[model samples]
Target: MTYDLLIIGGGINGCAIAREAALHGLKVLLVERDDLAAHTSSASTKLIHGGLRYLEFYDFKLVAEALRERERLVKAAPHIIWPMRFVLPHGNAVRPWWMVRLGLYLYDFLGGKMTLARSRGLRSSDAAYTAPLKGGHKGFVYSDAFVDDARLTVLNAMDAAANGADVLVGIAVESARREDGVWRATLSDWRTVEARAIVNAAGPWVHEMLGSLGVNAASNVRLVKGSHIVVPKLYEGDHAYILQQPDRRIVFAIPYQGGTEIGTTDVPVERPEDAQIDDGEIAYLCEAANRHFTKQIAPGDVTSTWSGVRPLYDDGASEAKEVTRDYVLELDTNGPALLSIFGGKITTARHLAEEALGKLAAPLGFRAHPVTRARVFPGGAITDFPTFLTQVRQTWPFLGEKRAERMARAYGSMLAEMLAGVQSEADLGSDLGGGLTELEARWLHDREWARSPDDALMRRSKVGLHLTPAEHDRFSQHWAALFG
Candidate 1:
């Protein structure tokens, strides 16, 4: 059977588009080469914020849209997405206080303020706040949001499937061509499907997708590699710090999964798939973090590291960080109507989807309804996160408070569904260490399309960062015995 839309990538953009289109009464098919969010999506810094730095590039429209979406995501998925206060400490070479304040003021007013707190200045004398830096450093606290990027992608795909979209994982597209009026696409996963229009939301491989279809538009993608390191928690509170480097790039030290998450360098890359965290990048990150905080973190302190390529739109910026974070969609109406997306932040994926579909509607001949604005995602059915926590406590009283809270944050209301048949912690079965249970593994494998141990540990859940080497080996053996 033919579908009205075929999404090439299973990253956040593709999944969001699939969910949006499916909800709008269109037949949709989404195919991914690897597991969902295995590439750039999962490797993100995992922030759902308006690009505060994008203001320097004069991308007020993009920042405004992203800021609004940030608040929307926080409300829509309270379990996974929440407000985060970012502390930006001023350095000698950084922007002036008046400029920073102006930017923050515009940011607060650009997007219609809702639940998130407004930006403010902090004094060094505030005893309630611990000064991680030397004296004479002022701070600017602003609003942002954090999300489990990998889980967000999966949940979007799951919502699309629930809404009647054919979600196909581990399926690679071999070829796609326009035939007469419809597009014929062949798959490598022992299946072939046809669609009227194709969305080349392949993230870093967007240009490659267009090349596969022999379509050439204005090529404007700059593959910049960004790397992150996960270490043990260094701070006690939920606030994250934005550290300024001497080179003018900023690094983030955020609280992640009860640990400290730090990242990101912007180096130009030749290929997207070749992105990896090299020794120099790690050292650079550590040096940047150490420059701002009293606690010095060495390479050994890094429990885990990941790298991703950002497909940024080249605007003739000499520095990678100066490149615009806004996304641009190029629509070719000649054959099969290819929609190629370039450079988008994770915070604005939903808005990108809406804008993309609006452009493709006339060509595809499908009237898609607008539902994503008010609709909640798969695990976002509830509004109050505390109420959900109370219900979960009542259901699984045997589970420890921390474990229950972790599961609820990760799986939301679906925690009950995931742990439905289990009565006690022992019933959850063998411990894979790092709070990972055998029952959770089976559920991820059976329901979440987890094929390998890395898929289970790194993407589906971040248990890999906490697992001991021997425990990880044992879990790999168990996974091989069951799947291989």
Candidate 2:
């Protein structure tokens, strides 16, 4: 079947573009080589932030764009995206106090009319803020939002499918060529699909897709490998910390899934698949954390490590951290229209989608309108998540406070739909542990394009963090039996 747009990549960009285009009444098809967010989208610092450090490089435009998108995303998916307070402790070694304050002021101003709290100072004696930090250190607290990045991508894909777009996962576009005013793409499974326009949102494999189509892109993609480590809870609070290394690079210590997640070293990578965290990166991260927090961490303390290669737009920066995080969209309307996307962060993905569809509207002959702003995702209908949580607990008294809240956060407005007809805990079926019920897993597999147990465990939900090895085996067996 012929389509108006064929998107190659199931990452945030591809899925988001599909949602926007499909919402605009376009016949959109989005195919991904692996599970949704099997790569970079799931491996983020999990922040819907405005790139606070970008101010140092004078990336005002990017920061402003990100901040605007950040606001929209929080509104769009209140279930997955919520306000987070990040504390940046002042040290004599890093940027001066006056400079830091100026940058914070600019960040808040550029964001413009945000629901989150404004930046403020924390005195040295502020016990709650400075308890984990080195003694006599002052700090500043700023607001951003945290997100379930993988879910964000999945929800967009779901929205696209709901709007009559074809969402295919675990299928790679093996080749593509312009044929008689249309682009024919060959899938890995040997199926051929034709489209009026194509989008190369393939992330790291963008250039490879271009090569397959015989289009030599002028812009280059710089593969930068960023790795993060998950360690035991470093601090007692819900607030996250931003630590500055001697190299002027920033590392985050965010409270995640009953633990602390840190690291994300910006090392240049030669190959996209070479996203392994080296010993040096682990050591560097541990040392960076050790310098700031009173609680010291060693390499052995690390419980988990994850790495993702960023397909950043190459600007000839000396260091990986110095490279720009802004996206670049290249449209080649020369035969069958082809639009290529390079370099974008999760915070700005929805805006990128709107911009991408706007560019393709004329060539693809589609009426474009803004829909995602007003339309909420499947589980993001509620305005007040806290009140909704209380109601969820009241209705389902069988679930404890933590379990009910986790369910509400993960499924949001869909929690009731997912838990429909379940009158008691036993009715929910086997506890796969970590509040993950067999019924919930089935729903994810049946509805959310979850193919394997790992997809549900690691990406769809972070229940893997709470599951033991034996429980994981049980989950795997149960998921296989249910799906296979």
Model 2's alpha-carbon lDDT is: 0.90
**Residue range 1-484, candidate 2, lDDT tens digits:** 8999999999999999999988888899999989999998888889999999999999999999999888888888899999999989886348898999999999999999988899989865667778888856577989998899999999999999999999888899989999999999999999999999999999998898899888989898999999999999999888999988899999999999889999678988888899889999999999989998999999999999899999999989888999999999999988999999999999888889999988998897776667776678879999899899989999998878888987788889988888888899998898876778888888898889999888998998888878899998988888878888
Model 2 vs. true fold: TM: 0.98
Task: Show the colliding residue pairs in model 2.
Answer: none
TM-score of each: 0.95, 0.98
Clash pairs, candidate 1, are none
Query: lDDT per residue, candidate 1, 240-274, as tens digits?
Result: 98887788788999998778899888989999877
Candidate 2 stretches with Cα past 4 Å from truth are none
TM-score top scorer: 2
After best superposition, candidate 2 residue 409: deviation in angstroms? 0.9
Q: What is the lDDT of residue 204 in candidate 2?
A: 91
Query: Tell me, what's the RMSD of every candidate?
Result: 1.8, 1.3
